[model samples]
Target: MPLAKDRNTLRRDGVQFSDPVAADTLIFAGALVCLDASGNAVPGATSTTLKARGVAQEQVDNTGGAAGDLSVESRRGVFQFANSTSTDQITRADIGSECYIVDDQTVAKTSATNTRSVAGVIRDVDSNGVWVEI
Candidate 1:
């Protein structure tokens, strides 16, 4: 399975993806999205067994649907989100460091005692919020 003569390889931008939504999940537009332990899409939160994926592209209501019944569209990139708290705040000094998820719209400097999942790397901090590369 080696000698292939110019295979037409399929390509994707890798910036966007659609993932099956978890049961009872309602991911809002522009919310930080993550994959749960079962690889289902859910709103990012301060919980373990979650992996930050990207920002939700649009609101997807799956509150009554089971897993895989609906999917959410998300895009990976640097996005600004609300900072956490004084104790968990992300600062300019923390640039390029990993940030933790406080909720779909907030990120913290720590992992909330390792209960939170890694949201993304801190790209920049501003008066408005922290820019995270998800």
Candidate 2:
């Protein structure tokens, strides 16, 4: 099928999102975040089952609440995070390659034997940290 005439399309910036936080989850502002198996926001960590969402926009404490009791605002874009050490460290050659979540603020070169989930692609690496296109 094809458009018969004119049509309107909805558009968005595609960089930000607001999703419900997982129960007993405490997401800190500026920390890397991910969605768990149930699609609830949680701090990014070395887990093979999590999907990297984005950086948490603000702190949201759901320690005393159930799932969906609160929401978290996250922004998706390129961000810098700490690089893993030793065998897990990211190097300049790893640019444009995929990285894994080491923690809320760190990424590694590999998935640590599938014990970690994909963080994002490496855009650049510097003395400070790895710039990830999440």
TM-score for each model: 0.97, 0.93
User: Which sections of candidate 1 miss by over 4 Å?
Assistant: none
Q: Write the per-residue lDDT of candidate 2 for residues 4-71, one digit (tens) a residue.
A: 99999899898999999999889999999999999999999889899999999899999988999999
**Cα deviation of 133, candidate 1, in Å:** 0.2
**Could you give me the TM-score of model 1 versus the true structure?**
0.97
Query: What is each predicted model's overall lDDT from 0 to 1?
Result: 0.94, 0.95
Q: Please report, as a residue range, the 10-residue window in candidate 2 with the lowest summed lDDT.
A: 6-15
Model 1 lDDT vs. the true structure?
Answer: 0.94
Task: Score residue 39 of candidate 2 by CA lDDT.
Answer: 96
